[model samples]
Target: MRLENVSVRYHRRGPWVLRQADAEVGPGEVAVVLGRNGAGKSTLLQVTAGVLRPTRGRVVDRPRHVGWVPERFPADQPFTVAYYLTAMARVAGLSAAEADRAVDEWTSRLGIAGFRRVRLADLSKGTAQKVGLAQAMLRPPGLLVLDEPWEGLDAAARDLVPLVVDEVLAAGGRVLVSDHRNETVRLPGARRWTVAEGTVTETGPDEPEDVAVVEVAVPAARVAGTVARLRAAGHQVLRVRAAGRARDGATPGVGPRPPAADDTALPDEVAR
Candidate 1:
């Protein structure tokens, strides 16, 4: 999908919030929109999601099924969580049975299954955000747009955002997301789209930083689990290799070695 020379403003005489913004997101690609507060990031996303019409230019080749999740979900609706999601699923072209299954599947995936009977207005902000996410994903859309998707989500829910993005991309869909918390690192290789002064530009991928390379030897069976634990703790593991045979028949485990004089040391906990 592409935004072609789009320009938007609230009124005819009002200043434009987006000035001739031109951008494209291709299938299987994730674009992360970045900008300071009030820099028209939300407006650009709204335009991409087709929630608001552009005053000038057009959105071309947009898919019929586009899912949009706003930064702050409008949870003041008078419907229960299950009802709202079911309704949204039906609106998205799901059959009655499909809608029921979709609502059930997503609520469980989002950890909101316990709140199915609770009204939207009564749910906590984090829970409401989960509902918003679940609704957007009722059907695998051709284009998925998210604005501050991580806000108000708990740690587990926050971790689920990237998994959803990956699912869409893996299924040959496009994803466009706007975030202020520099969380794009979670979506590795995502193109960066920066909005500034009412203009949008695609920036090149950031260069990787230099860091001390650590090689650890672990049992082949434990390599996967060990790497996951290290990465979860914010340590970058360069690689893992099979331990060489010990001449004395001792069990080989990863033991810390002192850092070189010019190299920075790993954290104490990690080293141990």
Candidate 2:
């Protein structure tokens, strides 16, 4: 999938959020989009996902199919989790029975079974986020645009989300995700794009330093093991960082912190 000189304007006579933003994400490749908070990262993902139209340029999808999950899901309805997912499955071209089965399988797979019968409005933010993932996987469209996909998940769920993404790519699916997490950098051979000042640049090995931060959530007991895995995989270990203050004697999951975006930069994880 590629965008040709794309630009998006939210209002008349206003500046475009993205300007002359060209990008290409290929099959078997994942590209990480980066910027500081409120820095148009999410907007770029929207344009790629076809949810937003470019004001001046065009987006072309080689496969002609795309799956999109936004920063916040549109689930303010009086529907059960199963109901909403089943509806999305139908939209994805699944038969009623097939959608039911998919919902069953995914809810179980994502460990969201307990919330299956609950209404979406009553669910917590993390549970809602899991539903977003389920919808993306339910169809496995050619291109996936996920924005902060792991925003509200617990540590176990966050770890499992990457596994789902790996499965999507192994099956020849392409994904574009922007999150406040470093795990995005660890995907093998995934491309990187940085957006700022209404322009986007495809970051290669030699790009100048901007901000370097990676977010991971890991239990204290598993820090050493996780670090070993990342190092073996050849990622710059930016430290086994954790977010939020921990209670007395409790293991904290690693959280995201800035890291040099250069692929060759080795960052020591700020182990908590």
Candidate 3:
């Protein structure tokens, strides 16, 4: 999707939250919005998700299925958790049977099954946040926008966030998220968008400075699997060297050898 010359303001003459912002995120890509609190990161995400119309420019090519989870869920609603999600599923065009199935599946996956019958207002902040995530993902979305998704999550839920992102990416969906708790370290290789002073700037992909590269030797037959495992763990594989040359230009073996059970040589996992 593309945000061309986007801008926003609450009132006709109020201070602009975002001004002349331009950005884009393609299929299967993830863009992490960054800034101090109230720096308009949410505004940019809203525009990207088509939840807010830009005061000036426009968002083009937004997907038909856009899953949006706000910073705080609207727990003031009278509906129960199950009722709200079921209603949202229907709104997303699912049939009665599909809605029920979806509600069950998502509530189970998000660990909110115990609160299914509880009213929205009765749930705690973390439980309500889980409901928010479940509703947005009632169906597979082409663009998933999450604003401060980690605000109320526990340790288990926090870890699940990256796995959820991985599923979306695997399905060729785009993900846009705003994080304040440094919880974005798990989303390796995501592009960064900084919102500040009523402006949005794309700072390119996230690349951490403190990093070390390690070499792993695997059999020719296991090379692909090893690389895939490394990448899934958020480690970038710089290159696949042949058997003749090691990192220090020394020969380690004559040909590829079988990898040991604990063959991994990666010291640390970093962003792509």
Per TM-score, the best of the predicted structures is: 1
Give per-residue CA lDDT, model 3, range 56-165, as digits (tens): 99998998999999999999999999999999999999999999999999899889999998999999999999999999899999999999998888766866788789
Candidate 3, pairs of clashing residues: none
- How close to the true structure is residue 121 of candidate 2, measured as C-alpha lDDT? 92
Question: Mind giving the per-residue lDDT tens digits that candidate 2 earns over 1-272?
Answer: 88899988899998778889988888877788889987799889888888887888888864556778888877698999988899999988999998988889989988899998899998888888888888887876788788988788776676676677787788788888887766565454567889989989896433433454455677778887887677445465544444556544544443334344764565443312
lDDT of each: 0.85, 0.77, 0.85
Pitting candidate 2 against candidate 3, the one with the higher TM-score is 3
| Worst-scoring 10-residue span by lDDT in model 2 | 263-272
Candidate 1, which ten residues in sequence have the lowest lDDT sum?
263-272
TM-score of 3: 0.78
lDDT, candidate 1, 1-272, per-residue tens: 88899999999899888899888888899999999999999999898999999999999988889989999999999999999999999999999999999999999999999999999999999999999999999999889999999888876787789889999999999999987665556776688888988899986556655545556667778877886677566564443545566434444564444346888754432221
Better of 1 and 2 by TM-score: 1
Better of 1 and 3 by lDDT: 3
TM-score of each: 0.79, 0.75, 0.78
C-alpha-based local distance difference test score of model 2: 0.77
What lDDT score goes with residue 148 in model 3? 93
